[model samples]
Target: MSTWKETLFGDPFAVEGDEIDETAQSEAELLAKGNVFEQPAATRGELWGYYLYYNGDNGFTMNSYMPNILQSLAYMGGFYYDGNTTAQNCNNMPEGAVCYVPWAGGSIPVASMLLYIQAIAFSIQFVLFTTFGSLGDYGRWNKWILLSATIIGCASQIIPMVWVNNDGSQWNGMMGMMCIALISYGASLVFYAAAFPLLADNLPVVRKARFDPNVSREDYVLVAEKWRNNVSAISTTFSNVGFLIVTAVLSGASFAPWEKYDFPDGVAHILGNAPIFNYIATVFCGGFWIINAIPYFLWVPAGRGGPQLPPGENHLTIGWKNIISSLREARKLRYLFMYIIAYFIFSDAVNTLNSMIGIIQGQITSFNGTQITILNLVSAVCSIIGCLAFLWIQRWFKIRTKTNLLIIIVLTAIVPIWGSIGIGSTKFGIHNTWELWVFYVWSGIFIAPIWAWQQTMLAELVPKGKENLFFGLFGVVNKASSWIGPVVIGAITQSTSNLWEGWPFVLGLFLIAIVIIFFIDVDKAKEDIRLYLLENSDEASVNGQEKSIHSVHDTDRPVSAKDEKFV
Candidate 1:
């Protein structure tokens, strides 16, 4: 068997079963003698790449631009073209000429247009994800694919700077720019997620002759699990840290001026000035993303390099077939399917809330750009803390994943409830903006832990040897209903001309998710996975070779379909 270094950092161009040179083999042995931990070098590099990727992507998309900067730009666009200048219709706009509709033709509501654009963008992303998601599983060029997608995504981010005009009057191309960016971003993520299991599967086994050679296979499994969890936690923590840093820097620079109060024609106007900040910030974010992705391209291995398709079968054919097969197999894994449903509903609410909060905050509380930045900064800090706390609780207190999820689900229900009530009335004693700030921060504290644990749970439950395909489905579940919440909220806000009314829709989504989650049996789902692997072990071999990392022990354990029971 090859040493870890030879297997991981071996020639990217090398095909499976390629003969190794004698000199290279000798060197691999020499390196293995001094290596203590036996961890794969390529695995370490991928972990670092994962950190940098999240830092750049999450910093720009989730923390800085999507929720904060982009919303401001949309608000400004609406002010200039939406034709709603009345105080009631334009409550979020700053004073003076800021509310003037400069565009000549009849205009749609900003919320409506924004939602339409998002719906279209995500729809395209869903298609692209289906096409590209499984390619990494078959092809040896996954790194090239990933790099191409990232470069395309980065380019899309820069396009908006040119298309979104400063005055918002010439922003007709912004929609197209956003759509392209969203599609590229979504495609990139599919491959990024597919890499996780590949890395996990390729961890170098410790040789018995050298280090703890008598270590049981069960202990190796445990060690692998520890590595997976640590990588997950570290990636999550770094993402939040990166977001916080970016938010602080941008906020401190006062890149965009606060909405200013102005009176014109005896009507108060809340003017949205300094529209150029959006363009500058987005450009900077795009540059940051590309620069940070270099490490990933250089370090992380591409495909698993274990197997390939039969003659005449390429990535496209294999990818589509896998997608269909996975869907069909979902019926056999009913509990896992239910978990996906639960995840869909809750994720929809979470994503919608993330997309619309800046607009909602501006409307309800008149929070300016600086205030929004601060809000995101606070959220980033809280998320980091929450992840660490959850890790600690799980490690030390030994809380079950299901119980922890239930608690988080219950806690998260407070977010939309407080928003709807606080914005609609002072009955909940949330009469002031500071109270709203507190509510937002409280919600942020729970958000990170929920996602961190959710990913861990899914990673645990996914059927072995099918991580790429299942994670692809997970991505679908995540993005599929994602457009629904935004569309519903946007339509409700437009129809009622009241943004506060949309909060109830989000509240309902969360409640439905919470209900569905109660039916998920974590232990039973894990057992089902084990049984499936036991039955299909031979069939799962690639190229007549057993390459699956999911090994079932010979020891007897509970195995029965009837044994499946909800917790």
Candidate 2:
């Protein structure tokens, strides 16, 4: 029987407690020397729990709850004369809110404050990701490093719950928590995403593909992609399910009449039900992560880590050197660079759009906890639908990855384009409360699974070797543009005091990026990477054969298994 059958499909003769015999040439072989044969490895479900909880906490606690509370807190307290007020001149800020910051002698809007905070947060995250340089992909570092980052982010969620008050003095606390959450999240996210390849590699099915002579190279390549997409879609779905779980719980609490039972004095303080629920949700998400991560740590084996480090290169310098050298090589790799530039801008626009929506949702809904939670539930549900839906569309039509992305990008742009309509008039777009429902539903379905497709995009463009080096740069570029969108949106919203004004800028960004992405030819990119590898490849780089078996992890963390052939 072909080994591809075993790698592509599970062994019918096998049972639980099985370890791949690494001394031989099976798929589960590891490059590393040590193996604890007695330890029971994770079932696929156990492996999945990592994505479920980590992503849930990161997406909900950091992106959804954190920003919502920060903006609302600033709204409850942020105010001034020259910036915005209910006097209805500069824009639409409520009356009597305590002003937080004096911006050029005028107070900035809560929305602008949140946007600026987002800008700062991403900037800080870029630095952290740059500094770390995918060190999590090497041996022994991935598990500990990923857990540390997760713990830090989860720990910060507690700050908002216990410390924040609407007395206007709590802005510093919120800002501090924001920094911790954002930086930890950036590191943890790239770290988390880096685990996918290890999981796919360790799968009995994927492992067998390596030694199967019956399978043609082209067939194996196609199967490899199909297999990867399946796993990634599952991971993305789990993330959404985590989002769904968090929002559903919040919605249940919001709709319940819990306000009647509260007896504590000075608890709600200056803030109301919405921010309080958000704080609770944040803590809940943290707990959810802790509970889910326990299984991953206990059951997931840390595989043989990344290749041995280069001589004389430390973590910081190594990643920088990799990026710099890659850039030097980029002059010859046209399509890859082209895709990177487009992906960079497109990712930034998407991120800014998310923050912009959150702030704007708070604006129109008056920060009503019930409506917000309900909307969150809608988005979470729709995000799942989007992931499954897009995956189905891709599989059913057999559409190329680029085509799927193009379709998704065009559909996603409709949101900002529609919002731009609000800049001119209040009839349609996101101006009305009803429109908020549409926005969430639309974003959940079209925008949620974009990152999965994006991963596939980079994989297609990268040469056979140098996956880590180039992917680190890809991760950097994906997030590096974050500083641009939020700052631009913040300035616009700050100047106009109308959140709608920023939508135009976001729309232009989305449209322009989509255009660039449309023109990128993946076929041409494949050719470029192929020719580049033939000419420029060196012994320092892992060759193509080893590349197929290379275990990808930020450092072979949660998804890693102790199989030698995998690396």
Candidate 3:
């Protein structure tokens, strides 16, 4: 009869006291042998694969829809020109609480309105993210939160069906509906806060390790360098994909005769229209989001040390105590704080640029809908390539964070110049539209890695066992900052752009962010991981001792006694 150990790890089994050996063993094996770090060494490719798919929809798919959604909403309110359709003018309603006509026949000052909305949305998301971020940490299942958000999102799209009229003006029904729709955005935060930490928890420690094991701890300092870069890329990609699709649709390409359908008045029309693709897309897209989330439940190990807070002592506590405790605990991790702050700054700029680009390209540029749509399609293809390439680069180069940051910085400096020129130019000497498309594609290569790096780094910044809390904070900052980027661009475009000057503010912000990126510390994070691993080695040695002692005892004891006991 084979021994249990023989059956598990295969053939000859020897437990080494080394830290690496301790991490290499599975949790079940560890339990059998009383080994700590019981969580198995997660395979490198497996961990990476899980996270890659998990996050694919997160920034790119969801956030990409932001500009388009807002645009649709504005369109329904009777805004015109800035890609406004006669179908969207909402100023002709009869007197009533619901019919305070907003933008009847002309553009509703989109840049200004968007700025205000984004600013408000930003603050709201921040509060929502902060409030619910710890749900996962406190041991709550996120599935319900996701489901609730999905339902709310679907319903929000339907509200427009009643308020929007054929003449492109809002009926009295819109005022009430807009309030509820904005409120619904909060539901998304609950889902994000829970999901981020869940992803972090899924990553194996080895996959999280960055620096060389030989490095010094004193030299290690946590910074947002690489993670920041990745977030920017991810956000940009999301913007790229959605904007590309919407722009393409508007680009004059005729929809398949059967592919088209009439949308009902109000919000439902915007949500379900040809360009917007209806609330069904929202439900399905959101459903897909939930589907991706399932693997985390199925495969990822639960957070160790149980919940971050004990029962009754959780966020439910009255008197602001929960809020204070959450803040205080979150503040303890200096690295995490730095990363979040960095995320706030750059994300604001990127998001704003995305919003501005959609509005400007759609309305301001003489480029027709077909041209805009074509450019966006090109952007999508480029983004996909860039995303895949970045992953390959990470694996092939075995590059350190500092090195990666340096590369990103170089690309950041160079690509924006090209992108800015493409956006700013009146003529490319050759239909200029194709030139913009080429630029969009080329720039995506540099932008695709931002989220991947940021997310992976954030996972590292989190305490080994408390990934939930760290990622909760991540979601808080990430969503909160989301509104800033778009608002800034909107405000600037509103104030600056005249017939003569173009929207240079977008390029200016990108440049400023690049300057900020230079100051971030990537090397320090790598060194920290190396030092932490070394310090924890001693605790790992007991596995070797237990195995050695047990083997010796077995050899010294009589074989006949062991056999008799077995019998």
Better of 2 and 3 by lDDT: 2
Quality of model 3 by C-alpha lDDT: 0.42
Return the clash pairs for model 1, or none.
93-270, 94-269, 94-270, 94-271, 95-269, 95-270, 95-271, 208-213
lDDT of 1: 0.58
State every prediction's TM-score relative to the real structure: 0.73, 0.79, 0.56
Candidate 2's clash total is 18
lDDT of 2: 0.64
Instruction: Write the candidate numbers in order of decreasing lDDT.
Output: 2, 1, 3
Q: Write one digit per residue (lDDT tens) for candidate 1, span 114-179.
A: 665676776676666666555654546566677887888888777766644454444445556666
**Where does candidate 2 stray beyond 4 Å?**
1-21, 24-58, 82-100, 103-106, 163-165, 195-233, 260-275, 300-308, 394-398, 536-567
> Which lDDT values do the candidates have, in the order given?
0.58, 0.64, 0.42
Candidate 3: list runs displaced more than 4 Å.
1-108, 139-141, 158-165, 171-254, 258-312, 316-340, 364-380, 409-436, 459-467, 497-567
Best by lDDT: 2
Name the regions of candidate 1 deviating beyond 4 angstroms: 1-50, 59-107, 163-165, 195-232, 255-275, 298-307, 310-313, 362-367, 394-397, 422-432, 459-469, 523-567
The alpha-carbon deviation from the true structure for residue 179 of candidate 2, after best TM-score superposition, in angstroms, is: 2.0
